[model samples]
Target chain A: MVTIKDVAKAANVSVTVVSKTLNGYSDVNEDTRRKVLKVAEELKYTPNMLAKNLKQKVTKSIALIFSNFERANGKDGVLFQIMSGIYAAAVDFKYEVVIYTRSLSEQQNISYWKFCKDHKIAGAVVTGLKTTDPYFQEIVNSDFPCVVLDTDLASEHTGSVSTDNVGAAKVAVEFLISKNHRKIGMINGHEFAVVSRQRLEGYKAALSEQDIDFDPTIVVNSDYSEESAYELADSYLQEHRDVTAIFFASDLMAIGFMNRCREIGVRIPEDISILGFDDIVLSSYTTPKLSTVRQNFHKLAYQACEQVIHILEKEEKGRHIMMPFKIVDRETIKEL
Target chain B: MVTIKDVAKAANVSVTVVSKTLNGYSDVNEDTRRKVLKVAEELKYTPNMLAKNLKQKVTKSIALIFSNFERANGKDGVLFQIMSGIYAAAVDFKYEVVIYTRSLSEQQNISYWKFCKDHKIAGAVVTGLKTTDPYFQEIVNSDFPCVVLDTDLASEHTGSVSTDNVGAAKVAVEFLISKNHRKIGMINGHEFAVVSRQRLEGYKAALSEQDIDFDPTIVVNSDYSEESAYELADSYLQEHRDVTAIFFASDLMAIGFMNRCREIGVRIPEDISILGFDDIVLSSYTTPKLSTVRQNFHKLAYQACEQVIHILEKEEKGRHIMMPFKIVDRETIKEL
Candidate 1:
């Protein structure tokens, strides 16, 4: 309830001074701004966001509209950790993060534009970008600056930061093949996500280099979860009994695959080597610490935040930034 | 950027009519509102929030301001599950959620009024209400409608929703005493959080009823994390060789204690029994499957949302709401 007027009264300055000082308008004197800020703090005065955001044309905030639809349940991998990085960077830049996602209700389909405009956000860090999602496309086309993560959207309008998915996948295959596993299977993510498509190409590319057959029969599409991986692997393994190793698109799916393997009396690494993508934290703790691709999610998320801020500042625009990825060696892989 | 004008043009209505319709004003007829909604959907027109929210005085959004400091690297309980529930509920209400927390630098020292005012939030859900926290007192004094979680700030001015921490703890200890644990160890939370004190008191109350000695030495204060739990349990076990069982204030802390136990080669249930509070998903997955006092976090979060909505509606100003807790019998417990 502490409005701009109260801030001005507390600071012993005009309302215009308080408003200008609070809005990052460089025209205000630093001494006056500091005095206003100090008094505002003591008085517990909250600047009127509605008035300032409208006039200044910046909230110094970012919107992260998570699709909670993707089941990211566990504390694993760099996925959520990467998110922490964005949070860290935002805080470092003195920006607020507004997270608008699905709550408990079935009717809670979010209105992206309204949420953004209502907040008067300077930019956004887009996550859980579903392929062909109309909402994603809308934000991409908007004048508002946005940084898309894990997806390469239309570069002309949006800044994107992604891990080198294809390179990571290729490294995983090279490691597996180096260990003398020729008949490898892959539990893939649904082709809707750009990362999944990139990973698949990497898998195929690795196979092609080694003169291995690109067997479609060995590939099964999973819906980015442990259970999905379990189901996909269950059927894939059943169909391709000769395969000695399997690569999963996600850590959860890999965990699921491991769970199913245990249920069906299949020994990991000894009976079949399993590799997971996303090297989440759980991968290291799993019974057979998974060998997998590691996307520097923290780096990716940080760069994403950095890029969005740059775009908001108009120092750069529509940047397609790609960070590096690696394959981490854990206990899951078998020796040749 | 499909604006209000586009929606109005498509719906064959004036901009005022579209605004009125979108804002749920009585001036607009139901037929016109329906037409605007339908055409807006067809064109994917999300209303401009800046124009609408300032005038209507409701964001239909809640800001969840968490304590940025003292969070674990991962495996956070109640808060994590509560978020899951909040997500489910927000979906139902069609309200956007904004996540706000102090930056690491500004965490211990924050200006709550400035944070809230700058955000332009109508209402907020304040989680992790630390007693010493400046924000706690600031929020308690604020006239704005807020829902504080996991605290007993039962007053006419604010709405509070939490599990009966004392009751749940008493039940846990009673269950253990029933199993004949005479010298039980405990790892409690930080002193600032009310649940830590409540649960600790409940532990003593249950012991008092059973005519057991309440040795202060048996209790160790942790920040409610695996590392702290590990340290507490490691030292406590070293000192109290007669301790037959250990009770944890949180599942993550219990998991930490278990890890410590593992390092020391003390077998769970056999060497030292463990009882965890908050039946997180980890409880079911951890080695020996943690026996726990289960606070229905999902329901708790859902109820918090519903309570805030109720308070906002002016239907009732119910201040204190307690969700039920249950004892989950799992592998970590044993008869002493």
Candidate 2:
């Protein structure tokens, strides 16, 4: 129960001086160090012993580094929920989490490596994987253990964690087919992410299974924003007059598609059925709601944290793990 | 440079055994502990000093506890951004963050508090204050060092951080007045928060400054969300047909105000100019954009961290610090 303050008061020095002496910050005098240590030893200061042993090795802290977390599109969605789940598990384990916002590019410029080095971060959780991010190589090559979400980061030094993207996407498109829609259009996300590519592949597979020829003219890529997707959905409604249903890569895009359809006198389901991926919180609240692929982000991040800890603690299970996804039926899709 | 894996390997024991032995988990065998310690000493294994100190004292973490982070209205705004600032500061300070979300009423279910205690949290950032919260009294009176964001937190705590709500709101309303608009309306956040009340005062202050009669009928109070604010804004617009411009408390509500105006066939600026507070990122992207008050949240959180750390470490200085806000002119406001 001996505190740094007690040591500071006893040694007649600032807490900063006491902290520097203990942490080997190399800024304090030798006499002060010995006096503090003598008092600390008498108090049975187990700060770096039983409670925090020189023999102790696990700090049980990890960093979840993402970009612009709160400003993520659509006001709410899968990303936040997944983050919540990670938080829940961490609290369960009594582990502390450090949230970092530096992207690979930002990391390169910000001198945050010095910060990371000083903090002794043992591992990290990475999200928002743009394909050509310069930080990926550093992460792959770093000494710390890591759990990557959404990114297809395969390396021996790191543990991969994500939802089954291809399967989720296929189920989304196939559900529209089950609803009896043949001519379908898609509002896709930016091509920089592996999930986007996987979802696109699933889109192709679903159409090929139903003998529906995939048409490039009806597909559009957006910046995963509601307004941009709304504009794209409006353009598609004009350009692809024959398309009966639409599949969006994200729930925000589906909302946009629906909003635009409403603006243009096209009724949801009755005029053009829409389906989306990442069945986030807003999916259930949107008027008429949205039928979409359900990626259990909570389970994904929770399992990712557990897996990364397992790997960091040398459980020696595997290098990669994937969480499951499902289809959530809502009102956005209709029987053609 | 030595890790738990190295110690475990050296002692020919599981890493969990090494962890439990050092953590004093009471489950590790005495013989196993002795062997782990011996090997760890030989390997010179050292756990992170900060993490160890956190374990010995508090959890080296703080929970920024919010009552229903997913507020029922689904309007994301300045609140979440403030949460981000808190998180960023926690990261910089090497403090672990845990977010506890439940309804304000359910907070005293006592489980969240027990979780914090179990995690050994040093303190918490209390947000989303409500009269019905049972846990509020317990936390306010506790020995823990808390930094509160809610303006209505019993006014007993010394380490409180907030924005200059009255000043921010006054600037926004005065801006509308300067533009030659006389008949202006107002939207206020939930009546529960003291911060909202200050803003309401600022609105009336602006009216009083211009010697205009204070019209309580033109003011509407709703939860800080788009959907809920939509109904209230709709009702206000329905009753007050002559109001030329309106000032909303938050940007999300501003978007809702515009959406309701759009529904009623009233155009922004041309029909009824609108001004929103808390110029969030979407304010720039919202259709016609949003003109409102802006709070630099990054700086706000940074200062809050500096304040809290100062209070805890520097023996309680600068008990109350208020950051400034500014008006952001956008497309929604009409020129005289």
Native contacts kept, each candidate: 0.38, 0.10
Write candidate 2's Cα lDDT for B1-336 as tens digits. Answer: 667788999999888889889888999888989999988877667665555555566455666666653452233444556667777777677666656665645565454445455445656676665645676666666555666664523233336667888888777788888998888888888887677898999989988999988898888787768777777766787789988888888888888777777778888889889998877766765667688888776567666665555555555643566778888898898976
Best by DockQ: 1
Error of 1 at A303 (Å): 2.1
Quote each prediction's TM-score: 0.84, 0.64
The parts of candidate 2 lying over 4 Å away from their true place are: A1-78, A89-126, A129-148, A151-164, A171-192, A210-336, B1-47, B50-63, B72-80, B100-124, B131-144, B150-157, B257-261, B264-271, B281-288, B334-336
lDDT for each residue of candidate 2 in A125-222, tens digit (9 for 90 to 100)? 77775656666667666656777888666565577777778777787888888888888888888876778888889899989988989998888788
Candidate 1 colliding pairs, count? 18
lDDT of 2: 0.72
State the C-alpha lDDT per candidate.
0.77, 0.72
In terms of lDDT, model 1 sits at 0.77
Model 2 deviation from the true structure expressed as Cα RMSD, one decimal place: 12.4
TM-score of chain B of each: 0.87, 0.79
